[model samples]
Target chain A: MAATRALGPAPSKTPDKPTDAAGQAPRRRPRAWRWADIAEFAGSAASALLLTWLIFDRFLPFRIQGVAFFVAWYALTLPIYWLVVRDGHGPVAARDRLASVLVTTGAAVALSPIFLVVGYVTYRGWSVIDFGFLAETMELTGPLSGADDGGLLHSLIGTLEQLGIATLIAVPLGVLTAVYLSEISGPLARPTRLVADAMTALPSIVAGLFVYSIVVIRTGWGFSGFAGSLALTILMLPTVTIAAEQVLRVVPGSLREAALALGSPYWRSVLLVVLPTARAGLATAVILGMARVVGETAPVLLTVGGTNILNVNPFSDYQDNIPLFVFNQIRSSKESFVDRAWGGALLLLALVLVLFVLARLAGGAGPGRRSRRKKGAAK
Target chain B: MTTQESEAPVTGQPVGGTLRGVGVSAWFGARKVLEGVDIDMRAGVVTALIGPSGCGKSTFLRILNRMHELVPIATLGGSVLLDGDDIYGTALPITEVRRRIGMVFQKPNPFPAMTIGDNVMAGLRLTGRKTANREQLIEESLRRAGLWNEVRNRLGAPAGGLSGGQQQRLCIARSLAVRPDVLLMDEPCSALDPTSTRRIEETILELKDQLTIVIVTHNMQQAQRVSEHCAFFLAAEDEPGRVVEQGETEHIFGSPEDPRTADYVNGRFG
Candidate 1:
């Protein structure tokens, strides 16, 4: 046909594309750090030192002489890229290369602190952590001793129970409130949104004080795990509500319209269609909210009043969480206590990493549509 | 190889219905879209609603089935009758009105998470018609929409994995699953390739014996090809839209009564 004639044969992309596909090209060499990379990095670093020398001697009073140089190096990259890359790759490619470099540098600078903290703690904490540190209680040993003296087992149980109660309280309330805000149209939507936004910024200490006054003083229960969990619930509700609301809002309008056209009532459509579509996002919200509050020492210290002995009854007695355990260990003036504090920090890091991995798995499969590979993995 | 002509035996008898709108006008918030529009879509015939862009042909189609009212700011000043009974009568539920009158959108919108077979069964399940055999219903609906042969082997695959044309046909199959009396389509083939468009057109012509259909389209030649009855809508310079002419498709295209209709059909102006 005329249309087929108009299409004709396609133009080749790269000269060797077809040959490469046919296995005509030679095998590739193993990659290595090459000579060109040295010029790029050396140029970037020298620019930083030169800018620091230019600025610190003349500009201002403050002695930001050390940090200013390292940061100034990033800004000096534009001129270097424009000078070194423009003639070879033209203006557009040169600009793209410069932008990529700037973004990569920014990412490296931002991530350095996280790596530094994990590295430092891992180095110090390895000595204290062992089979004994994981399974025993601090009740048996003195402040000055080896890994045989104490353990995080007691703290682990307290953290789990408190967080369980907190999850039990916050998840339903947050999901329901999000549904009301996103699905139902009513007079109370705006005011409820305002209140949730306000609560997200509520200081952890204030939540602890509020729970202390309302539950601790009224019931005369001094410091129980229940009170600590109540404070955690207060801190967690806003995060879950706001995130779940955002997820629910972006579920495409076409989907609801499709369900409605099938003669579904509003509530049934939301339950069957809208909620299922947002299932993964809702799981992410719960995990993130849990992570946000799990490291709180201020609220737990204020309410749960740290215990050294093993306790299981959250309803009746004081308990210890890892943050409170680490705080107490550091407060003691023994070298052994500092090592134990680092060991507790390492455990907390592992727990957080586990939560992130769980979140990634849950977030992998699309709410309604899963990749065949993901489905195979699930099976 | 076409899903048509095979005629799976889900329906005990063929079905269709009539729709009539009287003095219907619509508004979105403060802006009036349609003014004093009247139309009758009869059973067992294809009625094409045609106009230039923004002439309210699509709005009129949505209004016939009460979908316009779902918009938060939209208000309708009209009465629509389904087989002589007012759809707005307080005794009839909105759910019943919608179930009896089904629709296909401008774009293919199969539920992405659902399989092809499940997409066919969605309307039946949602509308509480569980007495029908689920397997027969899916097969008959896909056959009616002319998609059964291409997809018979992969019915359990996600509907989203199908190509655009197949997805559109799957949507048609989905709408047909409920066995509605009337089916409304909004520019069903505008987003498809020419081959898919021809296939959907053939399906439309074949489906005329079973359901009343009102299709909104901007393609004039397509209107001439698939429809029997044609209604032309037009609006001038910020004015509300209204029908200019209506009659048999052959007559409308050959010798229009109105100057505007003739100009539009002849491609002189929109």
Candidate 2:
């Protein structure tokens, strides 16, 4: 059987290959378009639209329009499209086109909510945000005051300081814990990993309560930015640790082995070679951790008693952040307060967006991203 | 190719150290990979270990530099000696053992994040050893690895930008910068094109005078072309790898004591 198989015609010699139909040269590129495809799409869309309109307006007893009309049209479009494409092309092409459409639709559906939230916030808050709004504070403003009278300057400062303190405390500890988990396989690694995994799932409110009990109630530190920072730290630690560990784990074992073979002690290899190799990934991890805790309202609300005045000292005094400001202002039954709350929400969204952009920039062309050298054909 | 025009002789004195393995056995967890292997790799000559896949050639090469121990469950028996001192003994630190006996893997592995110059100088920085002139040392190492002129102007370029062959040579220069007494290569040319493989073979020949070179290769012609001495390793089905024969390259290829060695050299069953 082996000899017969080996003696038989080679696979390349076979004449029935789809790519070489009628002995013609194979077309390397996939034909993405045809005149019939456009016709099929147009026909499917028009027929679906007409059918939905007739069903809503004429065929059905009740009249439906607006979003429901479009939703009905969309629902009817898929099968119509499949039928049209199947007739025009084949079952394979029809299936491929349907899959592409479904995937694209799913992506659009997933992204729509984010767009709606951002658009709504921008529309409501665009008129309120200005140079003065950013520069001024709400120290003198009251619930009766106009929306234009007070700004989120105090809240912004509190957010920045609290995040700053939280980052300082959490990032180092988290990164060190990550190093222990990923690089060193000591006895505590399993238990430490378990704790960090559990902490990642810990509710934001629980983190706030833990800090509230330990730092605010027990230590009598009172409701301050420091306490808020501690709560944020508790929330941010597991995030940074897990992410940093993931980043560290990807620093190729070959690189570490190369370092060791070069006579580097293990710690030195990890410190100089392994850490530097994973710098961009580590930065991204930190940014992810920051994003995780940036919009946390419960922790800020529970630890830092909301205040109106701009307080830069995170160590003392009640301070308010953007989320807390939004939470408190939105609950009030005042138009101006609601507008201010929308403005705060917009600011928080903008901050998170900025952080994501920064993460992209930091992670994009990391230290030896492909050759940037324009000259010399060494190859 | 352009770099070879300026045939600047490598500056460093030949400091090759004789290496000897006595009854070296290895196990990965409970599975025995190699058993009672003995070989002598003389200084200032290229010694090639030719074997089939899974015959423990690479494993033995890694054992020379103490890289074998990096695997968590890997265990070793017997001793490897460099210049008549037990490398596995506590007399020398593990880092020191690795430094003296360098390694080049099958695939080129320069630190992707580092610049070309930095990659060459990585050994110095990693080992925390200082030099009088950093620029001079970098140039010297690159020159010895036969990669100087091609990369001379772009020393600051990221190492990741280099071609596969250039990267391999850069790894060689990185290893050479540490000035190791013995260099162990585990099929260093297997990942390269024919031109790159030839270039690496030429490099191995050139570097032979400056360091004791021990290479593991499945390619018989490569072993014949580069090595002065050769050891043929073999393993039967479900058996641990062991040295079948050892002699000069000429004798091994011409008239081997073991028929298996003859078969392997003549392109029979690996």
Candidate 3:
């Protein structure tokens, strides 16, 4: 009763101060793009560029240009922009705007390399790339042959075969290890997790050397695509395991308790309820693992003996993949060889993109998302 | 005991099973929470365990269905009996005991990945129980939980899309689909609004004849409204929780044997 007495009545919808006859306060309209903001930005940027040009051409003894000029202009733009914003929106808003500008600049700087690499690869390789180039192989083409004479078909096949084998070997083992760590958590969990974490930092070249020494030399497997896949699997496992463990750990404990309360055994609860709920995240983990090993050139170079001729069978003779192809061809003095290497690099980028899209499509809708397939209906 | 006092039979199916917690005590690691709590939750009736926060009410509720042992350090010191059989004994497997005695938690936890119909039938698949008529069982369970009409059209929709109250009811339906003889609800309606709470109360009243229910609640009015037998739990400073009083709801509320019970029921002190 004392608690209820201290509470008091609910507040009125409108404030007690001034209001219109309808008991409504004045509305503050939301504007996504204000003309004043745009003007201030344009004015500050133009003045900064002008100041940078004057400093380089007239004020300074040296005429530094190119990237340095733009860098200087960017350096000057911040303070100018801050001052202009301050004139319009006061100091506090100007500070907030400056912080957002810095964040955007940081993001742009971080993203520049991806854009530059993809753009340069496309520009250099687009001339030699066509359906014929994709369909044909380097088996018939000589060192003096033109860029159009050979294609990446052999290397493409080798890369796909090796990646598929590696994924098949690694994903199950990694996911199971993750499940054991998160759900079962026995005495070995600590040591297992420690080993997995340590292996994540293991150099790709070391993985290649280990697999080469064991499979290629010890077992006399030679340098086959299978040897290359074994190397890739060693690199891929820890990545998948660590990422998958993190994902599985975040699944709400309530779901586990709910499953247990329903008379579901421990293993059944993990298999049916926990794993299915974390499906999307596990797919992402697998993709991250694949991405880490796909462009690994040193490992494939050491494990997979580079071959010009197409070799579809991974367990037999030497095979060629995209990274190895790019590495070998780029070293040649011929313009055609260099062009083909760029084309291979571009194709590799496109392949990774395609794999991401395919994995996303196959992983299906995440938990709580509308699947629209009607396949989840009860029996 | 309340179990012997209520022996009237008015149902078609094999109705509520008597659940008794005999001298139940619980500990998390070394710290004891509940000590020697014995209560007779009579068949075909709802027994409400009311107590202040941190009084081990929820722990006792979890103990009934063996969910208390899920915690790594949680330890139990007594036996829970369902239908005259010791649930803690070697006679029945842990999974079988849980299947016969189901539970609903305070927060609604419908599987987000599952559809409404699938969530209801999840228990059967989880426990590996095969039913000949799955659709009929789902419908019957939903009807019993009073959530059939609201979700019948969207059975294929994700269970997570439902409102909080509806999700709680769906959890209830999921628990009911296994056809458990006893249902333990741990403050099932504490997170819901007044109307949803009232609807769940009505569902509880309707379900009393089919299976035994033991609910732990903090609200005295809810305890009085939903349960026939009431047990008040209390824990003094530096002591483990124990039952202060246990009797019919009317007698416990109107004329209790303990002054603490009266003070608690009257909102004077907890």
The alpha-carbon RMSD values of the candidates against the true structure, listed in the order shown, are: 7.1, 7.5, 7.6
- Best by the DockQ measure: 3
Q: Per-residue error at A187 for model 2, in Å?
A: 3.0
- What TM-score should be assigned to candidate 3? 0.90
Identify the runs in model 3 with alpha carbons over 4 angstroms from their true place: A1-34, A59-62, A78-101, A358-379, B1-12
For residue B144, model 2's alpha carbon misses the true position, in angstroms, by 1.0
User: How well does candidate 1 reproduce the true complex, by DockQ?
Assistant: 0.36
lDDT digits (tens) for residues A138-257 of candidate 2: 888887898888898999999999999999999999999999999996999999999999999999999899888999889988999999999999999999999999999998999999
> Fnat for model 1?
0.42
lDDT (CA) for every model shown? Answer: 0.83, 0.88, 0.88
Query: Which scores higher on DockQ, 2 or 3?
Result: 3
Candidate 2 deviant stretches above 4 angstroms: A1-55, A58-71, A75-104, A368-379, B1-14
What is candidate 3's CAPRI-style docking category based on DockQ? medium
Using DockQ as the measure, what is the rank order of every candidate, best first?
3, 2, 1
Give candidate 1's error at residue B74 in angstroms. 0.6
List TM-scores for all candidates, in order.
0.85, 0.90, 0.90
Residue A118, model 1: Cα distance from true site in angstroms: 2.0
Backbone clashes (count) for model 3: 0
Q: Model 3, range A230-304, lDDT digits (tens) per residue? A: 999999999999999998999899999999899999999998899888888898889988988888998888889
